[model samples]
Every structure is written in structure tokens, then in C-alpha cells.
Target: MASVSNPILVTGEPYTPGLTREAVCETYGVLVDEIAKLGSAENPLGPSPKALIAIAAAMGLTEQYPSWTAEPLRKAIAARYDVAPDEVVCGTGETEVISFIIRAYAGVGDKILMYRPCFPIYHLFAENEGRVPVYVDMGREMDFRVDAYVEALKSEPIRIAFLTNPHSPSGKLMAEADIRRICEAAGDALVVMDEAYIHFTETEGSLHLVKEFPNLIVLRTFSKAFGLAGLRAGFGIAAPEIIRPLWNIKPTWNMGHMQMAGAAAALTDHEHIRRTVDLIVEMRGYIAQRMSGLTAFRMVPGSRSNFFLIEVMDDRLDSTIVFEKLLERGVIIKDGSVSFRGLDKRFLRSDVGSKVNMDRLADALAAIEQSL
Candidate 1:
């Protein structure tokens, strides 16, 4: 047997730098009565009340193992997306399902294709599973060119293609034409569309495309709009043929009883999803508008998504420096420099938080500049 490296090692350091409790409270400035967390990309809005109720109800059933197939969640996902129950597979979260898909579909000598400065986990998992990950460049210039993706696929034996529509970090939305084109070009390869941020976008998602393409797998998570990251529940929608293998690859009774119940309840909470998405969109607009007025940083074009990137030209303050400075001031944002080697030290990424929280970030950055 040949020795192989673990793919999990490829991940960046949790993306959350260390922070003191006092520092966090100072930056967010939340009273004990109010909740304030702006670090993670999670929805600022809390979990749905329905999800809360379900989790409470599920507490009594904790002793039992979850259904072997997570049938209830699978059914709910299928109904929500207008797909057959068998066409859905519930996992601990979309990331776990992504791992299962990549590990099951490809291995040594196989290759995977995805864009650079993406979800990071895709690259991490590819390396762990002994697969080659080809990254296509994306940035302020070409709007994460789909043509490059097509060209890459044309030349590569791409076993799988992982795409984050309205991509993370850059928040660049892909045109419908591009998605259809990629689907057509992929041939037998499995196309995994990570739509974790889709709930924040106005554009329609590619979930429905599963009816037409067996190779298309849409990964959805409640972590964002539904505000259930803590629960760790997500699902995959695809043709029943594709979903079956994913189901086999998933851990037995993977999603706990509480998570399933919470996710199922969240699926029915239209008001929560709607209100949360509205808040994110509003905050995103606010960030874009504020950044537009500033000359110090290069602001990437905003999409209807919940995140964006800012490029700081000041060589003295790399994202890591800014990250540490923000930590001292009680704020936290992802450092794009580590994951995006193509990006200079000045690039840092932040997600849409509440207006107050975002304002604090803007003020902090301005203060940091003035101090420099």
C-alpha cells in the first residue's frame, strides 16, 4: 500500500484568530441582555423560533440514535426543493456532505476543478483524499471568468467540479448562462454547487437543475439565512441516482435528533428566512456604499450575497496585521491573504453583520488608518 497524506491538513487555521472575551465584548459592545457576534459568516439573526421549539421537543429523544437514513430531513428537503425524497441526503452540514462527495467520487490519480479564493474546504478535502485540485483565478479584474472555468474543464479530466455560486470572499454572482454552460460541459463529471449563501441572493439557485442532470449536486445549509450553524444541519439535492451514493458515504445517523428537528422546523419558517435575508442585503448595501466613499481601499463590486472583499493598499498593514488590530479592538474578520496567495497582504474579507456591528468595523478600520 502506498502512503497517502490526510486532506484535512490543507485547511487554514480555523479562520478565527484568538480573541479575549473582553476584547470581543468591547468590539461588538453588546450588553449582557443583547447578543453580539460578528466574527463568523453566520447570519446575525438568531435561529428560527420554530427551530428552537423543535430542538426543545427533541431533547427528550436524545437517547435514541437518529433514523438510519435521516428520513424526515431528507423528506423535508425533497419537498422544499420539489425533488423526490430519494433525491435528498441530509448530513451534519454541507461541508461534511462535500467531503463525502469528494472522497467518494475521486481519489489518487484523479483530479478536481474549482476556482481559487473559494470556500477553502474544497481544496483542503481534495488534498486529504489524494486528488488534484486545479484552481482558476478570480478577482477584481475578470469577475471570476466562467470562460476560464470552461477552458480548464476542456483540458482536465475533472472528476468533480465544486462551484460556490455568488462565490465567497469576492461575492461574484455567476450568470445563469454560465451555470448551464458548465453543466453541459462537465459531461460525466459531478458538479457540486455550494449554495450556502444562496438564501442571501436574489438570483434563483441551480437546485432545480437536478431534475435535468444526474451529475448536478446542490449543497444547501441552514447556517446562513436560517441561522442554524450551531445545529450543524444541511442537505444535498440531486437526481436520486447521485443522492444514493452520497447517502451511503454519509455517517450513520449523522445528523443528531436535535439537528434534524431544528432543520425541519427551519424549513417551514419562511418569515425568519425572509427577514434574515432582508437584513443581510440591507447591511451589504450599507457596506458597499460606505466603501465606495473611501479612496484608501479597492472595493470589489457587490452582489446580492452577504459577503464582500476589501483591498487595502497600505503595505505596512497586511490583513494579518489588520486582523490582529481588529482583535485588540474587539472585531474579527476573515484574512483573505492566507487563503488567497494571489491577493496581497492588504486584502481582508468581512461578512454582512448588523448595521451597528458593521459601523463599528468601519470606524475601527478608519481609526487603524489614522493611527498608521
Candidate 2:
């Protein structure tokens, strides 16, 4: 067969996920257990016990199909959020939900607005769908300003806007007031707040805002605090008016039997959620304190999520080199440059791990400072 290509299939640069255990072990010739596994912002303590039990029960149903619409799970999520079941919609993951939002609401040449250096998927999906990607640059300081976002929304003929709360990579938690301001100014455009890490913060999240902002959509995932990354479960919350269109386009049986089972069980595991959040917040504070003292690095402030960024202050040391040195010591973190837009300077992003694992990172950074 002859090779062929199509312009329609083209996309922006591919996403770079954090280092996996297998890759790190193979590259560094170390045991998988030796790596801190902090790169991806996964739950360090592990998956919810209830989710594990539910998966085992659902495993026997491999031959059967999932219940279309994931009705029961949707009700469970709705009950938790105190919203109607119809207001909730599930996806394979939040990313899929995001793509659905783009495809359902945006057409070719329609502008999909987001902050520069925000989640990469927003732009990548917009481009793949032939929609225009509109970025409002987050200045060199990368401050979280709702005014800048509101101005962009007011000025542009935007069809959809995706903003992250407790934003990824930088981990800046958006205050409810700021969120409210943006939503109010959004006018007729749909406001999508991707709160994939909101559980890690004190902010009740933009969930409450959805009740007032008919154009609002809040996206949540089970990957972090719920420790269900492998399950790929996510859902969206919005008024029926905003959700109806997404439902019209989403395929039936989009989620699987096991995913429904595990997610439904995980949602009820409040003890697990409490413990995970507590541990992460504790460790995050400890590491942030230690990381700040390192003269070579400056810890970015206002991080309410599980992960935070550290800028390399020394001109001699680049973030890419720091990532490699940490990997050599069996510590894995994401290089900040590839993580978000407007991050032109050298920086590194790390997630909260257990005390022992975090200590390993602290020691590695101390050594890296002297050598650098």
C-alpha cells in the first residue's frame, strides 16, 4: 500500500505527560518503587479502597455493556453536588468532556478562548476541530487576573472559554469572586471552568456559580484525590440549558461498566478523599517551605493545589537540566516550559508525595544546588 497523508489530521505539538514508572526505571536503572512518582499530580497515597472493591465486582461484567447515560452514577454525582441528575454528564475523562464542549459549541473559524499557557488540550482540540484558538497572554509574572480574562471575552467574538481553577502546572487557585466576575462579563459565551484539582483547595469551586450563570460549565475528574486515574472517569456540571447541547452530540455507551462502578463507589469514599486531601496539603506546605530556601529557585506563591512550580533563578541552571538531575536521583517532575504558555523562563513543576518520597526530593535538590 502507498503512504498517504491528509492536512485535516494535522494538530499542534503533541502533549508531554509526566515520566512514568516504567520509563524512569528503564532509563535510570532503578526500581520502580525508588522513583518519587510526583510528575503527574496523581494521588500519592493511592486509589480509594471502595473503588478497588467496586472494580473487582464489575470485572465479572466484561461481557455485558454499560448502562447508557451512566444513569446511576450520574445520580450519585448529582446527589453529591446537590444538583439534578440531568445536570450531570459523564465522559471517559475530563479531556473528553472538554473536547465535547469544543465540538458541540464551536464551528470552524469560531473562536475558542482561553488563557495563554493554560491547559494545552483546549487549544489542541480547538485546532483539530478547525476552530480558532484565542489565547489571552498571562503576562511574564503569570498572575491570575480575572480582568484580563474578562477583557478578552468582552473584546473577542468568542464561542467558548475554558479556564482552569487551581490551574494546572502553576496551581493558582481562583477565588470565587474572580470567577463570578468573569462569568458575569462572559455575556452570551459559555464559560467552562476545568476544576480538575479543586478538591485540593478551600475554594468550594465554581459549582455554585453554575446555578446563577446559565452559561457556566464546571468539569471535574476522578484522577487526583479520588485516585482513579486508571479508571478514566470524569463529569460536567451545568444548567440543563447548557448541558442539553453536549448530550445531543455525546455518543451512547461512551463510558464503560467498570468506569461507572468504580466512580460510583469512589464518590461515596469521603474518608479516603479527606485523608488524601489532608496529606497532600500537609506535604505541599512542607515542600514549599523547603523549596523556597534554595537560593537557586523561587517558589511561585498562591498554590492551593497538590502541585506547584519553582522557577530556576540562577542563570547558569536550566529547568530541563534540573529535571534530568532529579531523574538521575530517581525523582521525576515536569519541566515547566513544556507545561504551559507564557512560561518562557526556566521552571519546574512537582507534586506532593509521601514524607519519605518528599525527603528524597529535598535531598536531591540540596545536592543539585551545590553541583549547579
The clash tally of candidate 2 reads 1
Candidate 2 structure quality by residue, lDDT tens digits, 1-372: 553342445534667788898898998987897888888889987899999999899899989887778887898999989999989889988988998899898888899888877878898778777898888776555667668788889898999988998887678877788888888888888899999999999567878888899989999999988999989999999998888777778887898888988999999999999999999889888888888778888778878889888788889889888888999999998887876655665888888889988888888888889886
Score every model by TM-score.
0.91, 0.95
- Cα lDDT over the full model 2: 0.86
Residue 269 of model 1, lDDT score: 99
Off by over 4 Å in 1: 1-37, 339-341
- Candidate 1 lDDT over residue span 147-175, tens digit each: 88988888889999989987876777887
Q: How does candidate 2 fare on TM-score?
A: 0.95
| Backbone clashes in model 2, listed as residue pairs | 117-341
Which of the numbered candidates is closest to the native, going by highest lDDT? 2
lDDT to native, each model: 0.79, 0.86
